[model samples]
Every structure is written in C-alpha cells, then in structure tokens.
Target: MSALPMLHRAVLAACLLSSIVAGCARKADLVITGGMVWTGLSSGRAQPGAVAIGRGRILAVGDSAAVAPYVGSRTRVLTAGGGLVMPGFVDGHTHFIDGGFQLASIDLRTAATPQEFIRRIAEYAQHLKPGQWITGGDWDHTLWKGAPLPRKDWIDSATPSNPVFVTRLDGHEALANSAAFRAANVSKDTPTPPGGEILRDPRTGEPQGIVKDQALGLVERAIPPPPPAERDSALARALAHAAALGVTATAHMNASWADFASYRRMERAGRMTLRVVLYLPLEQWRDIADTIRRQGQGDDWVRIGGCKGFMDGSAGSRTAYFFQPYADSAGYYGLLQHPEASMRAWIGAADSADLQVTVHAIGDRSNAMLLSIYDSVARAHGARDRRFRIEHAQHLRPEDMPAFGERGVIPSMQPYHAIDDGRWVEQRIGPERIRTTYAFRRLLDTGAKLAFGSDWTVAPLDPLLGVYAAVTRRTLDGKHPDGWVPEQKVTVAEALRAYTWG
Candidate 1:
C-alpha cells in the first residue's frame, strides 16, 4: 500500500464532512412527485414540482429532483401521473348534520309537477305506520314547467293516511297538508308570527299551504326532535359520505350547543374522518362561552369556529328583506329575520367573546344591515385580525359592495344558490335589482374575500358542480345559453381558489 499525502487526505476529509452534514438535515416522511402542484400561494403560481410532508407539516416544496433526497427508503410515494396536486379544498360553510339527515330523509327534490309530488309522498306514506308524521321533503314548485305554487288540497287527499310537512328547498317556505295543519292546530284565525307570513288564498282567505320564513316554526315546533342515537347514525353516515366526495373539511352552519357536543364526542372517538368547524346559533352564544373559552380556535381538523345569525330569509320565499317592494306583491317589501338592534347586540356579544361572527344576509337591506354591524365591530375592536364572515351575502346594493373589503369581511357565499334561484329571481326583485343579485364580480372587484360553499342540503354538496355554476352562471333548468348575468361570470381559477384552501 502507498502512503497518502497530507493534501489528498485533507481533500478526502472535506468530502466526508459534506456528506455527513447533508445526511443530518431534516428528511420527509412522504414526498409526492411528478405532478402540477398549485400551492394556492399568495402569488397564485403553479409549477411542476414535489411536496415534502413530515409527521403532518409540510417540510419543503421545490423541484422533484431536489426534494427526492429527503424521502427516506421507508417513505411511501404517490405518483401524480400528470394530475393536479392541490391543497385539499375547504367548503367554507354548510349544514353537515342537517345535510346528513336530509340524505336519510324523504327526498322531494325531483317532483317536477304537483301531481308527481303527491304521488311520491303517497309512495313514502305506504311504508309508515298510520298517524306517524312523514317529514323532510325539500320540494320546489318553481322547478315545474308551469312553476305553480301548490295548495294544501293537492297533497291533502294523497297523504291523508299520514301527516306530511315538506320544506321548500331554501327552507324559507314550506307546504303543509290539511292533515299536518290539523295536527299543528293551525287555522285561518291564527295570527302570523313576527317576521313571518302564512300565504293565504285571495278568494276565501284560508291558509294556502305555504308558510314563509318564521311561519315554518309553527309547523316545525310540532315535529319531535331527533333522539341522540339517530343523530349519531346520521353524523356517521354524513362523514362517510363526505369523505367519498373528497371533502376533507366542512363548516356546519347554525348548529346549537347540543350539536357541538355530538361533534366533540365523535372527534374524540376518532370516528370523524372530515375536518368540521361548528358554528353555534347566535342566540345560544351565552350558553357556550365557558366551553369555547377553553377550546378557542380549532386545529386543522375539528374545531368550534364561530356563531351564525340570520338577518333575513331567502329570496325564493319572498322573505328576504328588500329596500324596495317585491314584484309580485307591490308595496310589500320582504321581512327582516333580525331587527337592527337585535343584530347589533348579538354581534357585540360575539365580538366580546372573541368568536368570529357569520351572519346570513340574503337581501340588500339585510346585507346593508350586516355591513353596518360589521363596520361598527371594526371600529370598536380597533383593527384586530379577526376574520369575520358574512354567510350567504347573496344580494347587495352596488354602493355596499366596497364595505366588505374595507371591513375585511369574508363573503362565505354559495354559488349554487345563484344558478338555482336565478330562474325566478327576476320575478321577486324585478330586472334592476336582479343585476346586483348574486354579484360575485362586484364583490371580488371590491377585494372581498369570497369563500365558496354549497350550503349542502339546500343544494348539491359536490363542489365541482358549484365551480361550474359559478364560472358559467348556468341555471338549473338550462334556460340561458349565454348565461344568467354573464357579466358576473368568474374564472375557473377564482372559483377553484374559493373552494380550495382559500
């Protein structure tokens, strides 16, 4: 053997040290390679690259070759194979528990005609015991070719064996049979509750089977609450169904404290697969302060997020409080779900408790009222980074658009609503206000953070369908080839961001 020179030995030591240093650096547990990765980064950039995940957090993101070294021999690899690899999408708002119940309940979504609706209910009633309430038919008469609103007489004769109460798709209206009316003891003499109306026949002045807004509560109060076991099964089935649809995260809107406990129990047992963010009903905030103070903001998976308050009912039901009168009923503006004073009080409480507030404002007046309340909160809170949200900011005045961005309010909107409601929206608000209805472009232009969702049970939970609707503004009936309000059309990328981690 030849003796090594000092210079050569020093060079060899340097090479070994470099190897050791590189080996000691952090390594990734899993590295996804060979795909187009849209990071949903602020810059909105996409590159052919790889992502490195260790334990749970992302370790690195760079070129495939550079990231490959971090992948250990034990690591499992996923080859994207030219597919898009993006962050899991987040449905900013939904009613998961209610949606779960809807999945299990009597579905009336497809009864195109009033006769067809009666036939379906009669079919469902055959399986039930006599006098047992046949609940949960989310029907819409507007979808029928002639678009005629049905009366009690239509379903009364068919479902006479069983009492039936079917909600309108928007939950703003309900069609009840005479059997249901008799059970609830509702009569023509009964007075409508504040902020609610029972549609009556013009000729005879009798209850016309349609109950609008808070009037639904009259019939709803007659139905018994679901037992705990039934709720559990519903949630389990919902989680499984949501997982199948590629929904990794969801936010349950307008849930009460009792509902939150169910979610917490499910999460603790590791039975929940999708991430859930619960929003307590605004009125129930005082009851959950201690629980929320301990839990605060949630992790990436399950959390108690905020409170949801209703400012107005939906447009389809003619309960969405408008500045001007509805076309069908002159001098008859829609009702407000919450008074301005009541909204201010609830919002102030939510702010004080450090809870992010999400208000449902579907009409221009409702939207404006919410904006004013949010503006007040901003001034009182003094520029804190709390991300307040406006659930279903569906209708707006052009002047009020900028307030959303100025106040940093995230418009947690449902795009499917526009497509679903657009077919008949003109009849409700007339042509002029309809221009500002479902104003996605105007909201975006004002720099409002538009967070998209399906509202699930109200519409389909499939986010892809929502993306198509938002980008195309296509009515469900396929009426407009050019698109409903084509000017409000958003890009595929913008719709994708609203559904993605955004």
Candidate 2:
C-alpha cells in the first residue's frame, strides 16, 4: 500500500472520533433517571426513562441511555427509584398566606367533640399573651355526634384572658368567645347585618357566639391585625410548603392588597420559590385593573390576572343558596352573599376590564345564578378567552351541567371535598341531589375543563390526596366502602390533568 493512502485513512478515523465525542458531551444542570416518566401527553409511559434539565428548562426527556449524554460533572442527579415522574402540580385555587398562618396556628379541625374543641382552645390560649387574640383554629363541628355549633359559653372560661375568634373548617362561620364579643361591642341587641346572621339562643334571644357568612366581620373587625413582619413570615412558610408539595404554581384566590404587596416583595427579593397568580376580591376589580393597566400584568413569577367573588356561603354552614330549602330547615333557603343586581354589576364591570372572574358557588341556586350571569356577560361582550371560573362548583342542577362546557367556563373544583363532605352532605341536601354533586366525570364528558385545587386550610394541601378522592370517591368516614356517588368518579389520569395541565 502507498504511504499517502495510509495517512488519509488515519485522518478520516481521527475526524470521526472527534465527532462522536462532541455529540456525547452535552452539559445539563440536572438529570433525573430510573423513573416511569409519564410525559403527561396522550401517549403512554416512558419506562426506564430519564430527564435532563438545563437553565431552569427541560433539555431532554427520553430513554435513560438517550439522556445519559447530557450528564456533566456539575449536574445534580436525582434518582426516582422506580417511582412515577411527571410535571409539577399547579393548584388552581389557594389561600396561600392564610394556609401559612394555619400552619403556625393551632389546628382544631380534627377535634372530635365539644369538650375536645374547648380543651384545644384552652391549651392554645395558654401559649399566647393576654392581649394577643387567638384565631385560625378551623374547627369542624361535623365530627361531633350532633354537629352542634360551638357557643361562647363552651370556651369562655378557657379563653378568659385572650380574646378568641376562631373559624370553622369551611371559613364561612366562626365562634367568638365572650371576650371577643365584648371587644367587638357585639351585644344581643346588635342587629344582624344584611347577608349575615348572628345566631341567638332560641329562648333567651342572646348572641350564641356562632356568627355566619358576612356576620363574621362583626367579630373579625375587632381582632387585631397581624403586623407586617408576621405576615412576611407566614408568606415564607406558605412558599416553602408549596415547594415541598411539588407544586410549581398556584392561583391565590381572594387575596387582600397586603397579600399582593407581600408577594411582590418576595419576588423582588428573589425569595419566591414558585409562580403565583393573584386574584383580588371582585369588589376591588377596578383597582386591580388600574394596577394592571399602569404596570401591565406582571411577569410569570408574580402577576395579577383575576377577580374572585362569592355568590353564597359554604354548605357546611348551611348558607349555600339552593333552589329549595335544606332538608334540616324547611322553608329556610340559604342566603345569598350579594344581591343578584349587585353581582351582575360587579361581574359586568370586571368583564369589561378584561379580567378573569372566579366566583365561589356551592349550591344549585348559586351555581345556576352565576351561570346565567356569565352567559349574559359573554353574550354582551362577544367572545374572548374570558376563562371565567366557578370555584368549588360543588353542587349543580342536572340541566345546568352542559352550560359549563357550552359557555367555555372552567370548574375550579377541589376533589377532596367530595369525600370529606360525603360523610353527612346527604343529611343537608338529601340523597336526590347527591347524583350531580362533585360530578367530575360528568363535567369532563360535557367538555368542561376541570381545574383542580387544594382549597388549603379547608382541606389538605396535597394534590395526591385530591387525586385519590377523585379516583376512589370513597368517603373518608369509611361509610361508602365502594364509593360515594360512584358515577361521578374520575380516573387518576383525568384528575392529574386537572391538577397539572388544566
């Protein structure tokens, strides 16, 4: 062979070797391997797969060998250990700051009896200073045998020094100790405000400490507000909770201006661990719109996008407006939080400003009314991506089910409510209405988008628990071994999509 031919062959082999090394040496900031990766697409599993991430974005996701090239000296590798790997969950609704405060405060949601409830308050009060008010217990009376509302008399002696104003698990009603009432100047003679009810003794006509709906403000206004430092701490705790839960984003519903300021401060300081979309109260829609118009709807990490309102109160409190009176209280239909005309005006104004609107509608009447209002608004405004949502769309009339999909409305639902509320909801509304309650499968079949959330503080913050509830429909009380309204149950994948993509 000629010497020239040997030299050319050697050069060609060197070039090929260099090309192979270059192709196998790409860098990644992080790599996750050994997982059953559900790409979250319609296509099924990516078994024994790996993911490569770079500069805060997914660089590659495929077979483990395919992603091996992106691993580098500085890359952080996480092993899934045969567990499922998918997109981080997005909570469609949350009271984030409130959840943080709940984490730090005494939790009474698990209290089983009246005595237990009083004992918990007594213990909690001892930890606080005399002037410091005790709040945020989130007690649930439904756990008790009779489901009796707590009275001031029950906790007055225990919370003598510290004024106590604690809410129920639903946050719609609250029990105020005698000290709190005196501090708020709420007397037996104090007339119940419109859209609110101050429960009084049947014979004595004295305030019984159980305040429902708008009446909660009567005592809440008197409680000292938390200082800015405390608020910041709570916000930080909530952010940490979100990160630990594998939640990448959350929509904060019914946040105050102070909450918005705190979120901005966190973002500015680079302390935010997840994305937040703040929704101010519907009454403040004009203010939010002005802020958005001036500053422009903010960046991905912090943005103002929607307004939240309430058509009625929660079912547990018996304030969820329904088409017919509750079974327990004949001729006593639930109260509407706002007049129909007022709701129309507020919704119309918000719609005109091009802000997304989400209203808390729990009962058949409230849901139907809101649907009508939304339909009217859509007809007048023509079509844009309004994405108007009904938070907690817990109960619905069968006829109104199709409107959600037809109108392009989103049902921002919390699956945990079905199992939690199932224990005794039949007693409140009766078995006939239970068919369409938490109709997850029915809504999806009708083409309505389902956005899942935790409604934290009212329920568990974990999305996995939510998925379990949706898929199983088994009541937490173990009464329904098979399922509660089994026809409404949805698949695990469907629930996951609602928590993530929806």
Root-mean-square deviation of every model: 9.3, 9.5
Per-model TM values vs. the true structure: 0.90, 0.91
**lDDT tens digits by residue: candidate 1, 179-201:** 88888889888898987889888
Q: Which prediction has the highest TM-score against the true structure?
A: 2
Deviation from native of the Cα of residue 360 in model 1, angstroms: 0.6
The TM-score measured for candidate 1 stands at 0.90
TM-score, model 2 to reference: 0.91
**Clashes in each model (backbone N, CA, C under 3 Å)?**
0, 0
Winning candidate number (lDDT): 2
lDDT for model 2 comes to: 0.86
